[model samples]
Target: MVHRMRLMMRIGRSFVSILFTAMLASPAIAQTYTVQAGDSLWKIAEKTKAHDVTVHQMIAAIHENNSALLGADIGNIKPGMELAIPSQTAASNASSKHATQLLSGTGSPFSTPTRNTRIDSIQKKISHIENEIEDTIEALTTSQDSFDAMVTP
Candidate 1:
């Protein structure tokens, strides 16, 4: 009888473990958000605090998860447009992918210099201007001193 009871206890423990594991593996359910009169993607994202996702990430997720419903330009979503908010993980992944693509792809036409390069260039221009100003001031000072000497009795 003791052996049968031990087996039953083991089975119960296994069942509980299985249930717990299933719960953990379950995916987060996606939610739907309807656009309000003055609702923007950012506003909606801010309102829906799903796992602390950012507005940009939320916008990307909405665009990707509901491409058919939202259309290509997620920015052009009108009032009363219903959007499907993705799970946190899914939204994060989609946002990351979108950002990567934007950076890698031809998003901007004009080429921008690196931060360091731009700073260095600005510093150089400032240095040149300062040198020119100093030269002008020195020339003016010398001219004034000479003029005063010539004028003195």
Candidate 2:
């Protein structure tokens, strides 16, 4: 039982360290592009094809990243609107991540699931950490009680 508790504590610490590292290593600062007059999403994607991704993929990524600014109708973007353009590698990774979540039955069916998916994942992690903390507290209380009983005699 003691060994198991030690292992659990170690795992918890490792998980926290990894989570912190990932937070620090957030995706590189996204490049921002300002919409120009008479420019369509397709045109922007084509002109900014710095990565190997297809025009469709680039447009989807740009829309996903800037959904808040683009609003419900991405096609209605106006001139001077700045959009965050994610790298192709980042876009590809996000696409694959979404696919994996869908395959695992944990993804939303909506076209834009990036924000929701991240929130769900973070919530799940928080729940798991809460459970682990409760377990650790119980174990520590039990150990303290055992020590007290032995000393009182």
Candidate 3:
């Protein structure tokens, strides 16, 4: 009976350890947000609390997540709208579980050299992604136009 008790305790400990490990290792979850009248992207971003990606970083994510809000400018998003938010987990995971989230765009005017460097790097990435999106949009528009031509004639 003592041996069985010891084995049960050990099993319990192992299960607890596994549960803690899983909690630590889980990916950030995604969330959905709605825009309110007078609501801004910056405000919504403030709520998301993602580290590496800013509210702006999510313009792409927003469009991808909420198919209904397409073509709306991220910078000038209106209120009374709903948006998809990235789980803090996914954002953290995207940065490889160790990546620090980006400093908020509203950081102090006294920016450090490191901040400048990071901004440059992020801007480059954003530019690349924007170019890709534009190319895709162009391709899709072209296809649509061609199809329209084909169907009309």
| Top TM-score hit | 1
lDDT of 2 by residue, 1-153 (tens): 999999999999999999999989996676888988766665676677556676656666776788788654445567999888888776654554543433233555434334434455577689999999999999999999999999995
Stretches off by above 4 angstroms in model 2 are 1-27, 94-153
lDDT of 1 by residue, 17-123 (tens): 99999989997676888887656555666677466666557756766777787543434557888788877777666655563332233363323333433454477
Local distance difference test scores for all models = 0.66, 0.68, 0.56
> Which portions of model 1 miss their true places by more than 4 Å?
1-15, 21-28, 96-153
The TM-score between candidate 1 and the true structure equals: 0.48
Off by over 4 Å in 3: 1-5, 17-30, 51-60, 92-153
For the record, the alpha-carbon RMSD of candidate 1 to the native fold, in angstroms, is 15.1
The residue pairs found clashing in candidate 1 are: none
CA lDDT for candidate 2: 0.68
Q: Comparing 2 and 3 by TM-score, which wins?
A: 2
Please state every model's RMSD to the true fold in angstroms.
15.1, 22.0, 16.9
By TM-score, is 1 or 3 better? Answer: 1
